[model samples]
Target: MPSGGSTLNAENSGNHTLPSTLAGVDPLSQFLTGPRAQAAFTLRVTMDPPFAIDVQDQAALTVIAAIQGGAWIIAAGTDPQFLAAGQAATVRGPAPYVVADAPDRAATVVIGPGQSCRTPAGDHVDVTMSHGVRSWGNSPDGDTVLLIGTYQSSAAAGQLAVSALPPLAVFDTQETDPALLGLIEREMSRPAPGQESALDRALDLLLLHLVRASVDRADAAGPSWATGTRDPVVARALEVLHAEPASAWTVAELAKRAHVSRATMASRFQAAVGQPPMTYLAAWRLALAADRLASSTATTAAIAQDVGYSSAFAFSAAFSRAYGVSPTGYRRAAEVS
Candidate 1:
């Protein structure tokens, strides 16, 4: 009953068209496509005043959009930011933060790892406070309403983009599209087959839009990887690297692809991207491999070959040097976490 003109329930979803794959050649699109959501955690929350939730879930990324009233996001050391109706904020995580009606309000609920909910006094509250399907809050008809989407497994691929953002990036009402927000809100509440996948794609689209908005801002403080996309030459080269991380790329080859000379490509790339092309490629490949290692059952050799490494041994050495852990150890740690 949202913008798409069909209920997301499975009974009607068969006739509902899935969104087209994001096929843009830009850096953000490429980054998102590689390690997009598989089964994201999304919820609608309603609350009243004098409420705060202490968040320590260590999720990779979270998008919090205000659907009704407003709330304050308080990350350590940074001043609290407010999200009024139709506004949104993205929180890059693994770090703990808090959300409340007022910046000074104490948290009454604590969200722990794996989204376990408890009180500050350590009594579990998830089941006790449940509202209904994919919804949770202190009050059923509270003045404030929020939609929260968390990306848990996309951390490795998202690091390049997230690193460029501050702990929180707030979007004012004018910057956010109301129709898109409504679509997400509607799809999230539907009890339909493939609903998880529907929400996953929707959340990915929202994140892509937010990254684009952040980069387009005149006062954006994002790193070279984000800001560099504005340059045609650097952007083309980035597209090449991200699109073909497994390709055996050289500076001359990259320059040729970007329609620039080798020397020109090298200088401009360094100035704009903050690293040599090969170095960036290596990091990208490793990031891809790391995510695969965590999320799939692929063998190290298979993953190595897939990401352009000559052999598992070579990949292991490079991965260890960069991540400070062997691939096996990294997988073990990921499983434990």
Candidate 2:
């Protein structure tokens, strides 16, 4: 497939609701609906064979999917993984890595701040070949086509999502919703009005699909959060926790909600979530508060109340303890960055 052949199209069949167990546990939904994710950064890269690019240490999570030929991903401290056409990979960063036709190929350029690229010797390497909208690379007719979706915010909720993932994860396109990818590809090449907004939504959907597919692989060894969603009792309790983060939930109350004995619920929740009920709830509330701080214009007191805290002082203390920064300070830093 040629790079220029990719076209942006309107309308798609990818719009769908969340799964039953995952309905209220919509982690991706929360991430996307939050302020930072709304401004998601994305790119469409086109390249010929014998190509390789390295991205330096960046505290961002990237979703890379191929649309044309194949490529190989080599993240620091991990083995090289190959990605065929239609396949996708998530590269968790704060570390450097390389993407190329093969593992042996050295990086020809380094991607830096603002997605700028330069030769290893520090000479600027301009991506003069632009194929379609938001697209750039070595050639406009490059054989290898890639869609890159990035989530670079350091917000607490965003970090929580990254914490549940392995440093490098891959899944086949067959496991993804075809329509979502189709919509992403179609929208990537159009400079139409509100295109950035459209791309943000599409990228979020694609990330959700890829992450869910990775977690749902038949192999049982997966994150406790993902595996817990499969257990009826634990799933129910999780749904409650997610649905009502401000409910001031207690262990017994959550157990009643899950329709199980306190002891039984405690044991199972521990096994499935790797944490006790109250402990999990505390973490969840803090995460919600963090997202509210970064994404909303609500007052500290209001945000605190929304996440179960009745006293603004108590919320500030807890928020500071968990994040080492006051809520206002955290919001300020996020805004500055």
Candidate 3:
């Protein structure tokens, strides 16, 4: 794979209803404002000849939905991979790559990101990206259109501060994933007035589902994040922790609740959940803390207390260490994402 974006033919993407703009403007952007974290920035790139996105300066994770022609993506780095339509790829770490409707065929690829992504223009469609990096289409049969959206990463998507994603990644919309595509069409076709934000939220969820599917496919064994909960005992322990992350829960207590010896609990817990019991507890606590921070206006101290922190400073430090953002910062970023 070369350091560049990839292309997929229309055959690659499951069928999708075209997005409609209101009187030449995207009505979809209105509803995607808060950290329900949705981005609806899209472009219909109609190219006559071959084109490519040169991603050298900026690094991002993109979700590409191919709607019309045949195309594939090539990953560029020390280790590169190529993905065809109905297949998605995720790129992390720093790598230079480009996507093309290569070998003299025309196609479209939709590029989007989940958490952390930065484009020089946050709200532009179809214009050549001037930030030294760019993505485009190569046409062999006819014109091509690429739907693209880039998001800020959780690691650095705070407020107006720009951040690059951890690495370059891509996710393909499954041929069997018609339900999700139908939702996309519905969102694109919904009547405006009040349906804006809700549509964006749905799109955000759709993107999340796509990533999860890709992760599931990529795992030869099982999902790393979902490791611990399959066993009944470990699952019960997790349920207890999740149900009451704010409660004072010791590993010993969790083990007892799960009806196992502490050593066995710890071992199974790590195997199933991908982390030691205590570490998972802290991580779960921080995750819930982020949800609270994003969805409410409570004071940091109050949120800390509610999520099991003794003080605002301790909570903030833990939250930052886990999610790399202070509680306040998370709230603000949630507002913009």
For each of the candidates, give the backbone clash count.
Answer: 0, 2, 40
Of the two candidates 2 and 3, the one with more favorable TM-score, higher being better, is: 2
Tens digit of lDDT per residue, candidate 3, span 236-298?
886765455566677788889978899988888777656677776575556545655776677
RMSD of each predicted structure: 8.8, 7.7, 12.6
Worst 10 residues of 3 by lDDT: 2-11
The candidate scoring highest on lDDT is 1
C-alpha lDDT values of all predictions: 0.76, 0.71, 0.45
Reference-based TM-score of each model = 0.83, 0.86, 0.63
Q: What alpha-carbon RMSD in Å does predicted model 3 have with respect to the real structure? A: 12.6
- How far residue 215's Cα lies from its native spot in candidate 1, in Å, is 1.6
| Model 2 C-alpha lDDT per residue in residues 1-337, reported as the tens digit of each score | 1122211000111222322322354455566555434556667888887788888737478888888898999987778999888888888876877889989998887877556678789877653444445688888778999888776654565555555567787678687666776778788777677777787778777776766776677663444666678889988888877777666567788789888899989999899878877777777777777777776687898777667776788889888888899989988986676
- True-vs-predicted CA distance for residue 36, candidate 1, Å: 2.5
Candidate 1 local lDDT, 1-337, one digit each (tens): 0011111000000111111221223345545666566667888888988899999988778889999999999998678999899998989877888989999998899998778899999998888777777788888888999998887645455776655567788998778888889998988678788888888888788877787788888766645678778789998998876666666678898899988999999988888878887888777777777777776788998777777776788889889988899999998977765
Candidate structures ordered by lDDT, highest first: 1, 2, 3
Q: List the residue pairs that clash in candidate 1.
A: none
Residue 175's C-alpha lDDT in candidate 2? 71
Compare candidates 1 and 2 on lDDT and give the better one. 1
